[model samples]
Target: MADTFAAIATPLGEGGVGIVRVSGPGSLNIMKVVFKECPDKVEPRHVYYGHALDASGNVIDEMICIYMRAPHTFTGEDVVEFQAHGSNVSLRLIVMSAISAGARIADPGEFTKLAFLNGKLDLSQAEAVIDLIKARSEKPLSIASDQLNGSLGQEIVAIRNNIKDVLAQMAVNIDFPDEDIEQVSCDEFITELKRQNDRLQSLIKSSEFGKIAREGIKIALVGRTNVGKSSLLNGLLGENRAIVTDIPGTTRDTIEESSSIGGYPIVVVDTAGIRDTDDVIEQIGIERSKNEIEEADLVVMVADGSTELAAEDFEIAEHVANKKVMLVINKEDLGMTAAQSDIDKLKSIIGCDTGDIVYTSVKTVKGIGKVRDAIERNLARGFIKSDGGNIVTNERHKDALVRAKAALVHGIELLEMREPLEVAEIEVHDSFQILGEIIGETASEEILDTVFSKFCLGK
Candidate 1:
């Protein structure tokens, strides 16, 4: 790039160290101009201790600076970094000095974008950079690492190559029109396309769990007041995140947190207990609880085993009947006072079976492990049908796969209908182009902007 770009590389805050980074063709000039006492001779990828100087040669901050030459740096361009004391003020001033010399502020994800543009990473791998930054759990982090290491990209490339081979065979039939060659090629194309089609179907199927692993599942804990919803939340999280009390409306607002369970990221929302109440705030909370139930992927219906199901309980059950649900009968330590008929009837209302039920006592923490196991089991059902690695986690990648898969299906259908090889070649070419979009081979500027916009500044 003609213009050098600078930014506060590390997050702005008080820490052990903060870095101001510069990248592009003019990166060295910014370093030489802003870093006072910089040696006449600069070494690529070598650290030098110095002070940042403004236009007047006034010292702004003391720091260790490093410069790396083009083609071997993160952005495949000359890069410089000023590692100073962790203060936003100092980092900003250093960046300002760099800008005054020959640099401008870098945009969000600009560095990674440069890497992608310079052949250092593909589009899917570039996306994983943001995913790695935002991951809150090990599952997503591992998935991101795999993707960044080219797990998904390699798989996509291999599939693209197979499709290319099939297209090459089709080209021979299209040009020659030899009856025997056409027949042989048609049989070969159907066989190979069926294999690739099955792979595409598996990836699309695995995308369900991949979405959960990447974005985390939103679970809403719903039940009538005094049914131990808060207790169950605290138990599930293994911390006193929610304030549990004997008071009817102690938790009058939703409490949300991120955690990991069963190799998946989970966003558990402890919404206020669902109940009909005259209290204005309680009514508002109850309304929010209803909304959470509607939005949640899994509706956890916690019921008290010591008390009979109330009208509100029946109403809550009916509301979540259309969602994926798990029934937790808490307070088992209090003895089974709530009748079997009532519990079974509640399960019937929610359309869940005996296997979906778990009994727990938040006091003694009895059956809490079973509750977690139950949740994991619920998430695991029909989720993994393959080795489980290389699952498609990005929606963009999945969408591309879907479109490519559709084109392949259409081509196969045409061949089966004894259509001309010319017509089938068009579908095959469409499939190739669609697959290329996943790796930015045919991606438009708009697609790149949308993908990189999700990143934080100075990434």
Candidate 2:
């Protein structure tokens, strides 16, 4: 029998409530010994107010207890949860009490590990639980929730089943030579393989958007001094996150904040203004700003809409020439000395495309919405739609999908080349095994340990 384990499930802090979770064979018996119930008999699946007692039968803490019977709990084993005061002393005492009552300290992710071992969840769903916890944006939370609910798992299972069907056909041909059943036709084999390959390709493509949603897009704000870069960042964030002043060189370091625009999470970074400076620190900051602009996923090159474009502005534009850039003209309240035609001339001189220009005034908050809309439009250009089905989110899944697709494709190629069934069978079998690994049908112990180890203790 698996050893019973207990742990403080919640983060370590003083709060309204703290939870001590127990799972495995001895969970109920341990609870019965430490938890004094009002009804005396342990009621399964019901919460009851109780007092936790030490070995001496003295009251250690007042608590609430909920007992979940085997095969119905998170780990598919008996579980007991102690809801006690969220004080450090009270919480630790409760855990220690459970430990003394024949429970062991749960390792990181031990509870979830039990869940996986007991068939309560697959590898993907268990992973989604952690992803949900670490999700930084609403979209990511939604995606992770979908995965946790078995959406992604079901999709992988479906694809795996398709591969299994093909393998089954190949197996019949191999196992029934006396029946004289005709082997799978090359044309038919290639057709089905192409279809499955297409499906896998579609999923791989979905990762482009899934990746953007999972890892937020980086937008670096770059421009010459006194060009309203800080104000633009403040405008996008809807708060005075960056210090904005009439003085030049006010922001000497990068200021970063996360915000969502049109359902996309973006990290807006305001860097030191790009200009020649006498101050050593300011020059260092400028150098760093140049580096950030180059490495940024999207560059918002801010310029003063009211003033004529300067040599420093042109220089900043030239620096970001190869990057995905948006020319943002700030301070529209004062109007520009350069007309749209003049702006056109500056765009040519700076080598930025005409469509990338965004005219805005941060003081009045004018054109900020337009700029936001433009960003969303640009980011959404190549986004993948899931069609309400399986899409991969991590490197492991991607690798499995790639290998499975490769095996299937190679199998089909063999059939097309009129190669012996023996040759094609190897690739097809390899593909089936790869698919099995994704759904944990053929996963190794090392893979399971590495995945579950990432989970928090007590799940």
Q: Which candidate is the best by TM-score?
A: 2
TM-score of 1: 0.89
**Model 1 clashing-pair count:** 0
User: Candidate 1 has which clashing residue pairs, if any?
Assistant: none
* Weakest ten-residue segment in model 2 by summed lDDT: 381-390
Any idea what lDDT model 2 has?
Answer: 0.81
lDDT of 2 by residue, 228-263 (tens): 888888889999998888999999988889998766
For each candidate, what TM-score against the reference?
0.89, 0.93
CA-lDDT, candidates in order: 0.85, 0.81
Off by over 4 Å in 1: 178-184, 238-241, 252-255, 276-284, 308-315, 344-355, 363-370, 382-386
- Which candidate ranks first by lDDT, i.e. highest? 1
